[model samples]
Target: MSTAVRRRRALTGRGAGALLAGLLLVIAANLLAAPILLYVALLLFLLVLFAVLVVHIPRRSGPVTRRISTDLLTVGEESQVAVRFDLRALRIPHGIWHDQLPPAVSGDATGEFPTDNGTSIRYAITGVRRGVWAVGPLTLHTIDPFGFAQRQQEFGETRTVTVVPEVVPLAPLSSNIGAAGGTAHTSSTRLGQGSDNLSPRFYVSGDSMRRIHWRATAHRGDLMVRQEEEESSPDALVVLDRTARRWERQGPTADVAFETAVSACASVALHLVQEGYGVDVLDSAGTVLGRLRGHEDDRDGLLVALAMVRPQGEARDIVSLFDGTPPGPLVLITGHLDEEDAALLRHGGASAPILLMTDPLPGAAEAAARLGWSSAPLRDDIGAAWEDALPARMATGGGHVQR
Candidate 1:
């Protein structure tokens, strides 16, 4: 119990005992039969009456119950935190209630209800920021009928809620090949043919029958075959820097950068997924966040996983992570960048497009220029940068074709 509550209990006990003692004295004085005894009895009776009238009086009190619908939510979104107060056998004329909200939720209104009888009250809270929020030990205070004493009750369980960042869209930018006065030609090392299928096209004059599409010939009126073409559309691999040092602060400075990275990755992944391109996301610790396998239903799971992403103690070295032969088009998002990191990416064998996203570093533009990479500064408008870095025509009907 709190010190204040213990003190109040002690005061109430003493006052009750004193009132009882005065009543007993008055009863004994009535039996004395002498005038002085009678006068003394009347005086003691008056004193007891005064004590009861001025000090001891019924106070308001009852049990309070609260229930939170969810312990996790997203920023800038409203989650229903149901608060229920149960009052029983307590005649509370009027009382004000204040719910202790976490610092992240910056607002004055939580839930306040006045009651004269045993009843239940409910209210909702809307969280507006990210991080863990605590819903607290409710406090209730009331003044006694005589106004000489006050009673307070505290109840409800402490809860924690985690709020994640929000996701937005990105803008469009020109491709490096297009800017270099060379028509962009889509080429891939993967063995494949016409857009998707990997089977070879049928023989023309000396064409081999093995290359013919028997299924297509049966469906179509004429003979049809697959074409042997190198995989043109390269996969997009997104890498997010989630090292402990990256998200060192809990305030707007570091937190905003972390959120921006998450938002950018999510937006780009979703956009690419919708555009019929395979997408893979990797965190700083070399953990694959998501690898969509031509399945759109898995998008929700990806988002939920991202929502729970927290900085870990694992130290991530960007240079070593992508050291050897690289995969497809790589997009690296980080809060810090160095010369060695730039060199590692440039020599990382990422022949496909390489996009670097990081906080505004001292030599960001210069490093990007050296590596022949298009740089996007981390800002409130990072979503725009993400969109701009993507290929111009990345839709279902259109394919990255060679000129």
Candidate 2:
């Protein structure tokens, strides 16, 4: 867009060839005493001057309307766009065009087409990384057929592309949670007379005629009454560490480790949601970024939230993340496994925390080993790893309470 750049592009490839021809003309004229050589040099100089003018002249491209298949996408999925340019009654010859693309996107952003036959430009966009990115306004560099000059023009407006994290079914925790014919983390209590789909409930007094279970009353010969509501603890609580420092290997830039951490969290969160659990994604400061309440909640909403999460570069208070929650299974996802970070898992109010990391954590592992807590590597292939690790750790019996 700068004047300097426009001036540079104006130097067409054919202009150089023409200049060469002019030089040869002058040489022959000098040797043969030909007067045409002077005219040839003049012509070459005039042509070069014309190129300069062509670059400096303001050129506006035909009005264009932009169309993208979608503005929202999953990390591994691809989206595409088509731009329609009105070329009717237009004087544009052949032009090279380029659309601005985000760094996380993979594919060619440039294209070339003659305006004589068509008015559309199309490109496919795939996101290899997760995050919020800016996708475009278009820029054009057009070349004249004579090669004497070029024209530069830019049009359209920048658009945002939100790329959410990839989600896969999480490895099931080795417990009765999966056996409940639903996702509740623990074995359901006795089904109460009320609330739909009872997961084992407790019997209470003051039972109404409609509230009492007739089948249970007949079996026990007493008024079998229960609250239809299920206990909340049997549900899983997933904690994510968004501290800026923990995910960073360098300054604010997060490496693949952080990405892995996010993917791990997303996979686990999606799994829990499917199995019927609620997930609250938070930062190190306990700042609530988003939540997904099992199958009852919007699945894409959670992924969209996860897609926008970025490393905060602060030390997240991992240990106390579940300080006041009704106890159940606690799953924490982070990059490196460290003692302080692991402490959140060790001391969390739950019976024992299930610590999952982007990769293997020796310090955390040793801590988990000694404390009898369930801990394991969280990887790109998280479902398989979780499926493999959960049972062994549970069978070994996650350590006894220290508090």
Count the clashes in each prediction: 8, 15
lDDT of 1 by residue, 1-403 (tens): 1212322441244445555665565666666644565565456445545544443355334555556565556556665655556655345544556666765654343344565454455556665655565666666655444333445566666667666556664432234324321123222344552356555344477666767888767777556677755554445566777776655565443476777777777776665555445666878787878875456555655666677676675545544555354544567776666655554445255434545455645766556547655455677786556544443422212333222
Quantify all predictions' global Cα lDDT against the true fold: 0.56, 0.63
Looking at model 2, report the run of 10 residues with the lowest lDDT sum: 1-10
Question: Looking at model 1, which ten-residue stretch has the lowest summed lDDT?
Answer: 179-188
Root-mean-square deviation of candidate 2: 8.7
Question: Number of clashes in model 1?
Answer: 8
Error at 291, model 2, angstroms: 1.3
In model 1, which runs have C-alpha deviations exceeding 4 angstroms? 1-72, 109-111, 116-124, 172-235, 244-254, 290-329, 346-358, 391-403
Clashes of 2: 15
